[model samples]
Target: MNVPKASEKECIILTISGRVQGIGYRRSAQQKAESLGLTGWVANLENGDVRMVAEGTPDQVDALELWCRNSGPRMARIDRVEVVRQQASGVFVGFVIR
Candidate 1:
C-alpha cells in the first residue's frame, strides 16, 4: 500500500449496479482500493449491486470512483458509479472483499 504523506485523508462511499454481483466486483474493488492505498471494504448487496467505502487522498478517491465507472473485473459490466462524500471514519485498516 502506498501510504499517503499526510494525515488529511478523505473518504467516499460508492454504490454501483448492473452486473455488479456474482461477477467478482467486490474482489476487483478490493484490489483497486489496495493498489491505491485506500482503506475500505467492498461488498455485494442483495439487490445485485455493489457498495464500498474508500478512504485516502482526495485524488485517489476520485480515481477509484472513476475506475468504477467501467473498469473492474473483466466480467463486471458496470453501468454507473454513484459517489457520496462523507466524513472519514478512520476505521478500516486495509481493503477487504466482503
Candidate 2:
C-alpha cells in the first residue's frame, strides 16, 4: 500500500515475454513510452524476452506497464510481464531501442 504521489517521479524495469522479439516490440515500446511523455529504453534480451526501463510519474509508468501486459507490439504475443519498481535514475533523455 505504498502509493506514490501524483507528481512523484519514478522508474520501473519490465521484462516481457512471449514472441517479443522481431515484432517491432522495441520500436513500438519506444513509441509508446514517448507518447506517454516518459524517458526510457527498450531492448531485446538474449533469452527471447523484452526489457523496458521507463522513468516518469507513477501514473505514466503504470499506464505503460498495463499496455505491455495486455496489448504489446502489434504482432506480438505477450504471455507474461515482470515488473520491478526502482529508484529513478535521472539520466534518460528519451526512449530508445537498445
Candidate 3:
C-alpha cells in the first residue's frame, strides 16, 4: 500500500450523474476549482456522467465539494454526487477541462 505523506494535500475524485453533460459542467467545475486554488481535471464520461479529480487543502476540497453537491451551473440538474478521497499526487499544476 502507498502511504500518503503528512504534508500532502488532500485529493478527491467526484462522480456526478444526471444531466451533467453538454451543460458546461466541466467548465464550471474548472472555474470553481481554480477559484479554490485546486489542481486537477474534470471530464465527461461515456456513460453520461461527469468525473472530476481535485487536489488541494482539505478546506478547499471540501468547499469545492459542497459547491458541487449544493450548487452547480444553472443548467445542470445533478442527481447524485459520489466522492472518493485519495492521496494527493502533487502532479497537477492547474485545474483543467478534459
Give the clashing residue pairs of candidate 3, or none: none
Q: After superposition, how far is residue 22 of candidate 3 from its true place, in Å?
A: 1.0
Q: How many backbone clashes does candidate 3 have?
A: 0
Off by over 4 Å in 3: 1-6
True lDDT of residue 75, candidate 1: 85
lDDT of 3 by residue, 1-98 (tens): 66344356889999999899988889999999999889999999999999999998888899999999988899999899999998788888889888
By TM-score, the candidates rank as: 3, 2, 1
lDDT of 3: 0.90
Give the TM-score of each candidate: 0.88, 0.89, 0.91
- The alpha-carbon root-mean-square deviation between model 2 and the true structure, to one decimal in Å, is 4.5
lDDT of 1 by residue, 1-98 (tens): 77554367778999998888877778778888998889988888888889999898898899999899968888888777788987677778889887
Q: How many angstroms is residue 55 displaced in model 1 relative to the true structure, after the best TM-score fit?
A: 0.4
Better of 1 and 2 by TM-score: 2
Q: What are the per-residue Cα lDDT tens digits for candidate 2 across 3-95?
A: 444247899999999999987888888888999988988888999999999999888999999999888767999889999998788788878
